[model samples]
Target: MAEPQIKDQRGWAPVDTGYLDNPKMLDVLDASGTAALMHLASVLYCAQHLTDGHIAPGIARRKVGGTKDDDRLLIDAGMWHEPGHDCPTCEQPEPNKVYVHDFLQHNRTAAKAKRASERASKAAKERWERQRAEQDTPTDATRMPDALHPAMLGDDSSNAEREKERKREGGGSRRTPSRPLPESWTPSPSHIEKCSKERIDLDHEAEKFRNNALAKDMRYANWDRAFTNWLSRDWVKRTSAGLDPMKDW
Candidate 1:
């Protein structure tokens, strides 16, 4: 023989056989009436119809595999309540409304759906905030590199960085000795002769002066002018002024 047919339903529903312990219910209702009440309870989970714990009489009877007679039995016993309110989610007016009494109290499925919707909404908001934050935030690439910033435009350290970049690109430790002196300072071989007398290698000294000035980030419109002035002072101090003949002429 075929196994006893199971009741048709959707998703999940809760049933508490514990109510069977009620003395009046156990003694008064037959099995068919009890079964009808349970069927309608599950049907109330359908938000499209039995929303908010109410069900249309025809749907309840049809799905319950009972009749209007079965429903009347439940109503007389105060087991069912009619549509008096709308579901927040479904929004059915009274004409289209059917509600289950205490739908929230016993329907775990509806409660679960509500919680899930709330969680989904919250997650979407957080994701949007994170994305917006990432967009508004800036990156290191947006800043000008220290090497490219003009010496006078930013800070004292910028000039030093600029000089280091020049050295890296042009090579360090040795600089060209033939660089021309600044026109305004007046150039002559006399500075070289004076340095030679002092036992200094003029070319090497000149190279060192240029490199040291650059490393210290000495700023001038013409570095050549500054360097020539420096050499002129040292040359004048070191060279003799005609052997200091004194008392005579």
Candidate 2:
């Protein structure tokens, strides 16, 4: 059977369901008697350290507090195999070491775990780079239009002509500059018709509008629009209330 591939081994260790019911495990449990826990502790220690089921003598004695008698019991029960034994599953056996039977078959080796970690890191880095590149690349909607590009303007004359065309089309970002109220400013015919329908005194409102603009030193890009807005909003209400429109200003 092919071994399962492990991409990351940080969290868990594999244990078979029939582990306690196995004949080899039964023999170790029965032979070790009161010392069975120590022998089992050695197995857990190897698993936690990702030793591929191999237990060093020093680790068994000092780390797991297991004596040579415990190792002998596991080895004799066929639960563990001594070094130099002809085991087909052992990858690189060291001298005087004992390996757990079928450890590699059930769990990840240290080498495999290291490789999985490196692969995960490399994949994460590649994903980050791809996302950053996508963000840095400009899409069509965000790119500047070729017609408005400064490099496409060619010269001063062409630029001025483009500006005039844009203003005529009323489709550019720039707005008309404002100036102080004109000395000859007057309400247009449309303004007169609107005021007449609304029963507003057009000439009186017009004179008041001019006086207020001059008194406040106001400026506007479109004086006609400003006067129309002022008439629509306040002139009718003030005249109905019998309040002088020029009193507030």
Candidate 3:
């Protein structure tokens, strides 16, 4: 039996309905599910075929912020190729595949290492600068002023002036104001030596006290007792204030 055939306006027979008869130009499409290989070939062919036409390959969006040639290099290295696809940059008519990791992995790794090194370098520089500044500064004792010591400068004039003022204020003017005898006054070297000896004795006592475990233990025990007492008193005050009763919980 002869099968009936259908024809189009151009006088070409209609495409076969069977799956085997209907052959697509490309065996595998892109991940976009579009038959990109055939389209790509067609685009390239049309570009080559026409002497003057808009056969330019579709341009990719340019990376704006500090665009690295590395990502573009990876693209050229065939990292993002579909099945039977060519490199867009090189126009290499070879099958190449593009992996997402290949482009990002190296860049991220380099960036992390660079960041760590920079942070470490910055920290070290800051520490060095601080130590240098400290070393350049004067010691605390040398920086302190001698004017702070009242004994170094003679300040007896102020007392003498006050005494004069007191004598003038009194209604009865005494012919002669009685004063203490200078013969009774004497600088005692023994007294000064004794005071120095006592100071040295106190320092030694402090050193001995620090060395003694019983003294340290007693100090800690006193502190703990005081803290516990304070805590108990505070708890009583807070309880009396109705803090616990007023709490939401």
Per-residue lDDT of 1-249 in model 1, one digit per residue for the tens?
Answer: 122223223345555677655543453256466445544444543543224454556656555577666655554554554444333543232453344545556555555666766787799999999999998876756543422312234445646544554464346542543233343443247666666676555665566555555555454444544445555543323323332112111
Which ten-residue region of model 2 has the weakest summed lDDT? Answer: 144-153
lDDT (CA) per prediction: 0.49, 0.66, 0.33
Better of 1 and 2 by lDDT: 2
**Residue 54 alpha-carbon offset, candidate 3, angstroms:** 31
**lDDT per residue as tens, model 2, 1-249:** 222343345635666687677787777767665335555555666666666776665565664566778777776776678876776866544575678777778777778777877898899999999999999998766654432322233456444544553454345643876577899889999898988787778887788778766655565667787677667755345673576444431
Task: State in Å the error of residue 49, model 3.
Answer: 42
Among all candidates shown, the one with the greatest lDDT:
2
Cα displacement (angstroms), candidate 1, residue 197, comes to: 61
The runs of at least 3 residues in candidate 2 whose Cα sits more than 4 Å from the true structure, single-residue gaps closed, are: 1-11, 33-50, 61-63, 86-92, 131-249
Q: lDDT score, residue 192, model 1?
A: 65
Clashes found in each candidate (C-alpha, N, C closer than 3 A): 5, 0, 4
Model 3 weakest lDDT span, ten residues long: 51-60
TM-score, candidate 3, is: 0.21
> For each candidate, C-alpha RMSD in Å?
19.8, 19.0, 27.0
Ranking by TM-score: 2, 1, 3
Q: Give the better candidate number (1 or 3) by lDDT.
A: 1
**In candidate 3, which residue ranges exceed 4 Å CA deviation?**
1-60, 63-115, 118-122, 125-129, 132-136, 139-148, 153-249
